[model samples]
Target: MSTPVLGNNKRASCGPGNGIRQNSLLLFLLLALASCTLVAAQQPPYDVYPEAKPPYYRVRYEASGKPGELIFPVNYTVWIPPQCETLRGVIVHQHGCGEGSCKSGLTGAFDLHWQALAQKHDCALVGPSYEQPQSADCQMWCDPRNGSDASFRQALTDLGQQSGHPELSSVPWALWGHSGGGHWAGGMVMLHPNRVAAAWLRSGVPLFEANPDRKSIQPHELPEAALKVPIMCNPGTKEGVTVKDGRFAGVWPANQTFFAEVRGKGGLVGVAVDPLTAHECGNQRYLAILWLDACLQARLPETNGHALREMSLEDSWLAVIDGKTATAAKDFDGEPLSAGWLPGERIAKAWMQYVNDTNITDDTPPSAPKEVRVVDGELTWAADADLESGLARFIIERDGEFLANVPEKSQNPFGRPLFQNLQYSDTPVQPLTQMRFAIPDGDDPQSHRYRVFAENTAGLKSKPAEVAP
Candidate 1:
């Protein structure tokens, strides 16, 4: 993984002594407690609007019954586009097991890339964080048959009332989950197939074969209804096939078993193996977003509040092609299968690129900024938007060292901004032609070499344009 350029904590030049460290720790604890108290006083219990800058709301729900039991509270967050008049569908991004992955769910709704797709399709982006601890068994929530499913449904209703988008309770869903969250997503599709438009399972799936030895996790049944929902199983190459005894060894096998059973029964399922790291989500979103975009286009109704359009086999390409060197259906040797399902031409090509390199190679970057200038502590530039992926954000550097990013305040909890239009005014908050940033407090603008690099939605960084010191 690439080291994060910004936000790395730099230790103080003069290290504090043990006594000072202890006092500082105590002060920090007291401040944290006071902050928590202030926040709780401002809002009702179980409700928290995360520090994300986006116009979204989050609510927490405590697990019912005992305190020391397996059950834990679920944190649900949803982002509705400011321009949306009437909702059409919803996209749910679920995280994996463990405290880290679950907490990572806090950023799902704020993801600009995911939000872009949802915005285009008039769908709301929602994320559910099941606060299962590190030591707890994932099955308690990963399996939709458990209390997690009920929590998810209830969250939708509660968030609907809170966000004033009550229609969210009834919209069809496009589900994406990573690791154990993948198990939950797949389980939800199987349990409520009619309500799902599509599902993307990344590196995890519910086991269909009965394991008498591990009876705690009951095997899930594959009903005919589930066959209607389009599903994709994406596992990393190193998980099982390449590294036999790795920690994620079971990932590929679970995906294979589920794919075989579902496809064998004429279920709409496909597998995309990530050629990169095992378990870690790397460039998977590029293809995942495109695939869901295609599915939502086919399944969602153009008019709001109407029933979802029935998916048709004829609308999807059905060809069996190797992920590498298979762009078009004609690229394959055999004829397109009658029962097989595939995405549109663009998405299919992207899937091929994704599986081959585990990265989407977009050579084109956003147009370079013109009329670049620095005044006092502020730097300003003008540039046009990238026609393909659209402009994501800008990177600023001083003397080739990472300085800051444009739109300094994080657009989402992940500390990245979508920068797309927020209000119904149908225009971006800051015009692409105009961007400004304040120099760091310690940096001397007169002597430093400042440069700006534009990043697109595909996460590609552009050639830097230097500003005269």
Candidate 2:
């Protein structure tokens, strides 16, 4: 089964168009990426082992996509925590090479294990199968196009949407895979680091040969910043059997090579070497969750949230705001609070709102160009236009001038939020005029400073605001 490629009609088009046209083209490309084939209309609840009496189980919504095309069907299994309201995190299980079978394949035993894990962690587990090939053709296994990265992503996305837990957005996620699934886990770490918080690979093969250029250009290459992400490799003590000539052949290396590679790159790599164990699912899983618990317990920095440094308009700098002790955020609403109010405070509302919208960008211009203002207890800008449509880019200006252009689609220098479809959520227009930014907080609040600017096509820039400290 192959990942789904979107129909041409679903794609964007352009013919000698301007910035707006170009932006549309970008949107099209992003949407085309949605071709990931993990589509199964969620079904009503049902029992898995209806006849099993009190200890019952069921994979509620299990269905393949429209038949015909290379159908890489992924099963979406939900492991609801006993206390759904107070959830810990999301766990994703990627299946390895096997013909589709819930009983005999990776999906079978994992469904039970995932459910147990979810119960233990007070979270949810979603196991998705990325085309576990029935045959191991060298060409097929080696081809990047043949991999299940897209299907895996789509599966995770579908799970998130259906689970309907707002906390999932905040909760971290761990990627677990065995054998071929492990290889895909590596790909996920390299390609979608922003979507995953950590990963554990159990006896998986290296899908890609390590190359310097591929390391740099490959969309899935591990980013330098991702060195912080935790990784684990639990290769079986015994070598895995290599299939040859349509038969199970010789054995391969039992060493934890990928574990070493990840460790070399400054990642926290866990290794459960040769523990008097056989090459089976049970052993691999034990190592996976043990590593998960350790990594998930750490308190990570809120790189993009409210706890970060604040931005000030004075010199286009970001500062940290320490409001930890406040019952609720101190109100700088109607009445201006001293020290925190920065230059771009006027446009801060518009900028922040644009970034947080969890929907596709309409790519339209703001209708009523209203300046930023603090209304009620929160900051808000009353723009008459469709504020959500315009393009947004983060401007890193040293002294009221452009320094480097950072596309929002750029990797989150951290390993969390793997498979992040942040780009798909909002279509950003290029050459933005008026811009807003959040201020970073720090131990010494006075040390940070930054400003926000709104630029127009006439080369006119909006007055910078002193971001509230």
Error of 1 at 184 (Å): 0.5
What are the Cα lDDT values of the candidates?
0.64, 0.35
**lDDT per residue (tens digit) for residues 196-231 in model 2:** 667776555343233342321122345764455556
Error of 1 at 260 (Å): 0.7
Could you estimate the TM-score for every candidate? 0.71, 0.43
Kindly provide the TM-score of model 1 when superposed on the true structure, using C-alpha atoms. Answer: 0.71
* Residue 153's lDDT in candidate 2: 43
What residue runs in model 1 are displaced by over 4 Å at the alpha carbon?
1-49, 52-54, 66-70, 318-340, 361-436, 440-453, 457-469
What's the CA error at residue 190 for candidate 1, in Å? 0.7
Provide backbone clash counts, one per model: 0, 59
Q: Each candidate: RMSD to true structure?
A: 11.7, 25.3
